[model samples]
Target: MKSTVEHLSPTRVRINVEVPFDELKPDFDRAYKKIAQQVRIPGFRPGKAPARILEARIGRAPVLDEVVNAAIPAKYQEAVVASDDVTPIGRPEIEVTEIADHERLTFTAEVDVRPEFELPELEGLTVEVDETEIGEDEVTEQLDQLRARFGTLAGVERAAQKGDYVQIDLSAAVDGTAIEEATTTGFSYEVGQGGLIDGIDEALEGMSADEEKTFTSTLVAGEYADREAEVTVKVTTVKERHLPDADDEFAQLASEFDTLDELTESLRERIGQSKRMEQAGQARDRLLEKLVEGTEVPLPESVVQAEVDSRAHDAVHAFDHDEDKFAEFLATQDKTREQFDAETREEAEKNVRYRLVLDALADREEISVGDQELTERILFQAQQYGMAPEQFVQQIQQAGQLGVIYQDVRRSKALIQAVRAATVTLPGGEVVDLSDLLGDDDADETVEEVPGEVVAESAEDVDGDAADDADTAEDKADAKA
Candidate 1:
């Protein structure tokens, strides 16, 4: 067996492979055994018929066909592995060129390959992020939130307004046909929260207790999804939240701190720490943008198209792959199918470019994802998708996406390395030290567990409000108890 590679373009290659008949003995044997089990021969048990006798009965063409079918995939993989220059990024398009009976078999495979490029000097890169300035207003806002958590809800005689909680009955109909699933009795909602029906907030703004109003909104889910419906909301009761005064007694009631001054100081420190984390995130984004913009990467058309197809498929999958339904769903957002496709393609191109650039940088920096790093990434993703780690691993393995996850982890670490190497400064031109947020230079240390730090967990953890919400909920429960 032999193989040679042809450079079709900077991002693609064509591999020509020749396998002699002697090298194909294993394939031929397996093919014969498989065919014999299916084709019955008199005087021979199933899968016991000799190859020559079976071929004599079925003809040489069938045997050759079976052998070629079984050999191509394995041979193609061998050819790819043998060529160090070919790092295929997408599926190959293979074509069998010739089959000289008793002599040799030949084929050619065209595939998208990773392009080679030199990475720019990362150490010389500089990016500016917003100054980390924790304002008193921010601390006050957090303090107010804490107070609101322990606040009591009291009946109000006035009209419902933003921040007011209301118990309401809702009923909806599409084209005068009532939707049973869309009706709910005694649903409690915050007046200003817009996550419910789109126009409900405005409808409830000036409605007093026992007041009813009818408005039009599009049903986002259920059988009548994406269709406009008449929604009637009746305010059964309106209540306002009364926060306790920010005094020493309130502080003792709300937190571990015994005095309001101590609590205020802690709130200020927490806000400052949060602001610094935000700055670190901004710095990372800016540094990555700079790296991507400063580098030139040849995008593989096939790879980009595959990503675009995947995204488009996911978008329409919920609609059962019905283009018309997807179009109607997009129409609700004031987007046309053409516009959506254009945007999807644009995003796919940008993603592919970003990946290619980061991959090159990873190679230049000799970045590697250890087993522990990979496991940590897998665990994090599993938690994100609300699945057990084992279940997520099985799913990704079935989809052949475990390699994708590995690459993602590698790229993340590479970006972190780039962030560490690049100089980050504040808007005021003062150099910012982000070692606490970016983690130390020790290669064995995982970024997911920075001591007493909140920023270095992961890329998504930088903006993690869920953890903060959980902490707030626990504190509130403790204070109430």
Candidate 2:
């Protein structure tokens, strides 16, 4: 058996293979054994018939066909393994060029493979991060939030206000046809919270208790989604929250701190920590943006198209594969199908490019993900999906996505390495210390910021958002059904 590779393109290759008949003994033996089990002769028991007898009983053509079918995939994989440089990313198109009876077998396989590219140095990348400043306004806002948590609700006689909690009965109909799923009684909603039907907040603001108002809003999650429906909301009762004054007593009641001054100071420290974390996230985003813009990573059209097709399928799957209904749903977002598809393709290309770049960097740097890191990521994802780790793992395995999760974790680790190698600076000319965030506590270590402020971007942000949109759309479709 022999194999040779032809460089069809930077991202594709063709492999030519030749297998002599003498080398196909194992294939013939396996084929004959399999055929013997399937075809039973009167004189011979199953598994005892000779290969020639089996071939004579069935046609020699059938045996040859089975051997060819079984041998192609196994031989193609062997050829791929023999040529280590060809890292195939998609299925190959195989054609048997010649089959000289009992003499030799020849074939060619064309496949899309990962493109060979040079990796850029990550150490010289610099990016700008927002200055972490905990101000009085931020602290006050935190204190206000804490106060609101401990506030008491009292029944009010006036019109419902923005902060007031209201008890209401809501019903809706589209074209005079009642939507049972859209009707609810004695529902408690806060004015201006803004998550319910679109116009509920505006309609509730000036309505007094026992007052009813009818408004038109688009239903988003049910059978009536993307359709305007007339909704009638009747205010049963309004209750205004009365917050305690920001005094020592209130501080003692709200937190572990007994003094309002102590509580405020703690709040400021917490806010500062949160801001620093935000700064770290921004720095990472900026670093990625710089790397993506500065690096010239060749994109594989096949891989990009695969991602685009997957994203588009997931998007329209929620409408029961109805393109027109999906277009209507897009119209609600002020998007047309053409525009949505264009954006999807662009995002898919960016995501594919980032993945390839990160993978190359990981390989060049010899970065590897450990079992603990992979398990931790799995656990985090489980929590996000509100599932137990074991159940999530099972689901991922069922979907054949365990490799995908591993790749994602590896890519994230590679991005982390890039971030560590990058220099981050603030507008005040002070270099920000990201050691705590990066888990490197050495104060003397200096990561020079990028020469200019660069925005960091993540492939996960693009792909994850696409996934979330698909999940949400599917959930809505299920609920409507």
Candidate 3:
């Protein structure tokens, strides 16, 4: 067996391979064994028929066809492995070039390969991040959030207002035809939360208990999705939350602190810490944008197209792949199909660019993700999806997404290394050291005290948040993979 690679472009390669008949003994044996089980012979039991006898019964063409099909993939992989510099990013397009009866088989494969590029000097690459600012108002807002968590809901004998929670019965109709699925009774919703049906919040405000209002709203789902309909809502009850006073007794009840002053001070410190962490996230984002924009990486067209195709598949997947329905959905967002496509292409290009740049950096720097970091990232993703670690692993495995996770972990670690090497400037022109936020050399204490539910979300949430464009492709590609 022999192989040679042709450099078609900076990011692609064509490999020519020739496998002599003697080298295909194993593949031929497997193919014959498989064919023998499917054919009947006078003297031989199933899967025990000799290869010659089976070929005589089924024709040599069928046997050769099976052998070629089975051998091409493994041979292509071998050719790739033999070419030390070739690293394929996607599946190869294999074409069988020739077959000499029982002498040799020849084939060619074209694939997208990672481009060889030089990494920019990591040290001294400067980027600006938002200044960390924790004002008294911000601290007070945190305190209010904490108090709201402990607040009690009480019945209010007045028209509903913003911040009030209400239980309501809702029904909708299109052209006077009632839609049963859109009707719900006793649904509890906050007046200004704004995640429910459109126009619902506006219709709910100023409505007293037992009072009803009929308004127009666009249906977001079901058969009438993206269609306008008239919705009638009746308020069953309105409740206003009564927050505890921000006093010493309340502080003792709500927190580990002993007094209100202590609690306020803790809130201020927590808020300041969160602000700094947010700055770290901004720094990561700015750094990534800078790396992607500043570097002139030659992206593989196939990779970018794969991303674009995956995104397009997902965009219309909700509409059952019906282009007309997707167009309708886009129309509801005031977006033309052309506009959506343009935006998707731009995002896909950025994603491919980011992945290529980071991968190159990772190689040049010999960056590697530790077992602990990989597991932590997996756990964080599972938590994000509300799945247990084992379940998430199984799901990604079934979807062939585990490799994407591995790549994400690697890219994130590589970016962190770059962050540490780069100079991050704050708004006031002070150089911010991200050593603590990005963690120490061993990275055992990478976790920072980010306020509120952010900590529970993920210790590295800030690091990955700013790279969402790249990370989103990883997530979506898992489905495509």
Note each model's CA RMSD in angstroms.
10.4, 8.1, 6.9
- What's model 1's overall lDDT? 0.79
How would you encode candidate 3's per-residue C-alpha lDDT over 1-481 as one tens digit per residue?
A: 8999999999889999999999999989999999998998999999999988887888999988988877776676567666767776755666789999889999997877677776678785898888777788888899999999999999999999999999999999999999999899999999999988898898888999999999999897898987889999999999999999999999999999999999999998888788777777777777777877778888788777877888899999988899998898798799999999999988887777777777777677676667787788888889999999999989977655666666666666667777788999976789988787888655632432221111110001012112222223223322222
lDDT of 2 by residue, 218-332 (tens): 8887777778999999999999999999999999998899999999999999998888877877876677677778777766667778778988999999988899989888998
lDDT of each: 0.79, 0.75, 0.78
Residue-level lDDT of model 1, residues 224-319, one tens digit each, is 987899999999999999999999999999999999999999999888888888777777677777877887888888878877898899999999
Instruction: State which candidate has the highest lDDT.
Output: 1
Q: What is residue 474's positional error in candidate 1, in angstroms?
A: 48
Which scores higher on lDDT, 1 or 2? 1
Candidate 3 local Cα displacement, residue 88, angstroms: 0.9
Which regions in candidate 1 have their CA more than 4 angstroms from the true location? 317-339, 443-481
Highest TM-score: give the candidate number. Answer: 3
> Which ten residues in a row are the worst by lDDT in model 2?
453-462
